[model samples]
Target chain A: MPPRPRRSYDQFCAAARALDAVGDRWTLLIVRELLLGPRRYTDLHADLPGVSTDVLASRLKDLEQSGLATRRRLPPPAAAYVYELTGRGRELTPVLRALAAWGAPELAERRPTDAVRAHWFALPLLDAVALEEGLVELSLEEGDFHVRRGSDGTVSYGDGPAPDEPDARMTLDAGTAVELGRGTLSVADGVRGGRIAVTGDGPLAKALRDG
Target chain B: MPPRPRRSYDQFCAAARALDAVGDRWTLLIVRELLLGPRRYTDLHADLPGVSTDVLASRLKDLEQSGLATRRRLPPPAAAYVYELTGRGRELTPVLRALAAWGAPELAERRPTDAVRAHWFALPLLDAVALEEGLVELSLEEGDFHVRRGSDGTVSYGDGPAPDEPDARMTLDAGTAVELGRGTLSVADGVRGGRIAVTGDGPLAKALRDG
Candidate 1:
């Protein structure tokens, strides 16, 4: 890409330059949707209802100009265009995650849902540093799941296979796993309370309880 | 504030919530500006030369509603007002700094300064976790500055009278510091070559050079 003219150092004193690029309300949200993966224009429109078609087009154009997003055609004869993040746009993920973490509590208070409740646990995964420290093994049985804790407090998933050296194993459905990650329930507490079952090493069970 | 009505799980989504709030281009920029300090409407307008008054006003309103910014009257005449970040708004400072760091190189290449350059260093002080380790003490004398490194590299600055125990003390004007930070000159090489001077503890001075 040809370089654009440099703005004066004094120009850096103002926040406008950054804001002008992503300051608009719709643009970042559009960027956020794209982060989950790419989607066609119609998918975006459906996802962001109440946004006028013209405004969406304009925001997308502005995003493209700012080097945040780009559009590409998909499929045969469909001419369906999808927008995806460029490298610059992906950089905003941490910002979006931080904002979400800050707002999550307030949002949960206002809208109590099974999914919203689950999000409380899962959202922290966005912080890879924290995730690497905390996660242990996850194991699934016929309808139950087990969680084992490592000495370092990392949780892992172990299930179903012929691995004799297992930490803690539980059996649960996929939805339950998703919900547990989302923070909907305390997996350790659930097992202790008999809402779930655990069949594994005692230390691992205790660690899961502690976690 | 009264509790808000229950929202659906989808509403808790970050992008959905952000769009429900500032979702336009100008509001985030407005938040960014306030982070440096508060500014009056006219000052903000000046900073964002391209944004029309109507759009600016709309963005301000959106920001106010989102709890990211608060507009306050500056005494005497209620007609005049300044916009400042709320606590929630100030949380975005790191995000803004990261974005600035990512964008700075590209911006510098495109727009080289024409006049005498002023150097500015904005390391994140409150959060040590955000910065890389390195402590260098700098002192100015006769339009030149000297740097000395310590055993532990924890960067800090003090604006008081000099202590008797400084490892090394070199002096230079602000412009030179700015230039060095921008990679225009190597601090170690400059000192060794006598383009810059070094006095006091040689090991500390050498460490600063290494840094």
Candidate 2:
């Protein structure tokens, strides 16, 4: 795709420059979606429920032009174009994490009109858990999702069931999950208090069970 | 003023909530201005060079409605309305710093079209210098500015000269200042190399001189 004209803050400040790139309404949200892993346009649209199709397409193009993401076709049986983050793009994960931590207080209440997805809580929940490496499938009242903690320290999560058999499976209500994300509740305490049920034969399951 | 209706992403994610509040164009830059301290409308307008007057007014109104900033009139002799950041708004400093650090490399080469401000480098330079507490007046070729390092761990910087006599006053060219902000050059090295001239009888000056 040809690059669109880039709008700039035009100031020499680094923060301003960063904001120039990602401060648009749906830009970082799109980055968050890409951080989960590569996804087809349909998948991204489905997961980010509120974004308009036009805005999503424009943001993906912007991400591509900015070198944060790229489109590639899958080989063979699953031949489909998907958007994925670049190394420079993945560096934005920390920036997203920082924003997530800072904004956590705002999630104390879910307004009557609020829309939600089980995977929208994925990143914070990933932060809440402590594990060196494992795949954990989470079953929340809202839906089911899976998270992977790589030995390389990189983490990623997606909606629905795990792409493969997960090392651990946890069942918890959305309230307990939100509490965990807010740091008001701990995974150990949740497990100990029986608010969270763990099932699996992996080390992660053993740790949760022992807690 | 009555609150304006807010537009939201409708998601339950903290980062998304934050974006709903500050993700608009020029919102964070306005936050950047308030971080310097209270500013009259004219002052904000002058510092933020590119924002349209209509947009600025709308953003200020949005910021007020969001509890990020508030406006009040100065007492007696200085009876003027000024906008300042609230504690909630001030908490965004670390977020800005993270973005600044992450975006520093984007600042390596100044585009001929880029706008320059001496005080714009203040936060990054403040990060560059290691200090417990002191007021440092910095004279850059672009302009003069001052930075305050408070004992309480709060720091602030403003355009133009120090409000009062400063503990240390250092003079250097804009290039050296940019280098300092980028962390490519240290204060000690700049001092020892005679690129930076430090003057004053205070401890900060003495440290800069002895180095």
Candidate 3:
């Protein structure tokens, strides 16, 4: 492969520089997908419904060149290639959270042409959940996904529940989760109102109840 | 104008929903410009050098329809239309800050074609500064700008020092400011080294020193 030429904004400002790296359409979203852990190209394509195959491949390449992601082959049994975020790339959680919170009001209603993903709600719900460091499993009507925030402030989410025993698990319906994103309801309020159920005996559940 | 349709990603996820709203080309960059308060169409055009007139106008229109920005004629004496971010739009500070921080490492050098703005560096410096609720003014070689965070976590920044008396003032040379953004130098270290001058008896300067 030839050396990738850098075509940054060339501006000194950090925001512009950052945009130069991830400002392209579909780049950050790719980062959003990979935050779940390593994913095969086909899995990435399935989750990111609207992106073209060419664009997806191109973005993965850009992310690799940008040092935000790395591709590796699964050994033996799986025999597949996967892409995953690096530590620097993982720093984007706060950025995604901020963007998701800012854009939540835009989702008042779903369009007929729109696509749905259950794990997509993870970042916004991150703010709604307790700040305690633990895994949170959410069993929504549409599908299941889980979110975990570490003590160092790193946050990651993936499809289904925690791989290990989750610190806490919540069986929340979609309506309650959407309402929480809309700022119309709180987690504690949802729990109290029976809109959301708590199943873990961790500090997270305790915090949610007290909140 | 007929009711501008809301073409949302019918996804249940907040991050996807956000991308549906702000995922368009140059949208967040426009948001970056508007964060400096308001700008005349001509001003926006000049600052956003590479954007074609048509795309800039179209993006501005989308912003207005999305309620992220609005246009109004300046009163009487200096009558002209200017676009400004709504309160909801200004909420992007943290998002922008996160992005700037992530992108800071990529600013290895400046190219000749790059246009430099003193204020363009503000977002990155925001994270470098103290978390106190006060305005800090910067008089750099390129231009002037100010940033302030409110008690409620609301942050607003603009082209110059506080319109009135700023809570604090700091005169930072370009080199020192860039160093701070790059994570190589601390604000206190700069202040102590005389590369950054601290002024005013406000809590901000005190915090910078302690920081």
Q: What order do candidates take by DockQ, descending?
A: 3, 2, 1
The alpha-carbon deviation from the true structure for residue B149 of candidate 3, after best TM-score superposition, in angstroms, is 4.0
For model 2, the docking class works out as medium
Model 3 residue B52 CA deviation (Å) reads 1.5
Stretches of candidate 2 exceeding 4 Å from the true structure: A131-137, A146-170, A198-211, B130-133, B148-155, B162-170, B189-211
- Flag the better candidate by TM-score, 1 or 2: 2
Candidate 3: residue A210 lDDT (0-100) = 63
Q: TM-score for all predictions?
A: 0.52, 0.86, 0.92
Return whichever of 1 and 2 wins on lDDT.
2
Give the clashing pairs for model 2.
none
TM-score of 1: 0.52
Whole-model lDDT for model 1 versus the true structure? 0.50
Clashes of each: 48, 0, 0
For DockQ, the strongest prediction is 3
On a 0 to 1 TM-score scale, where does candidate 3 land against the true structure? 0.92
lDDT, candidate 3, B1-211, per-residue tens: 6866756545556777677667776788888889887799998887777888998998899888778899999998989999998887777777888888787766667777888888887877876764588888889989888888889966677886668787777888877887888789998889889888778786787888767
Candidate 1 lDDT for residue B95: 53
- What global local distance difference test value does model 2 have? 0.83
Interface RMSD of 2: 1.3
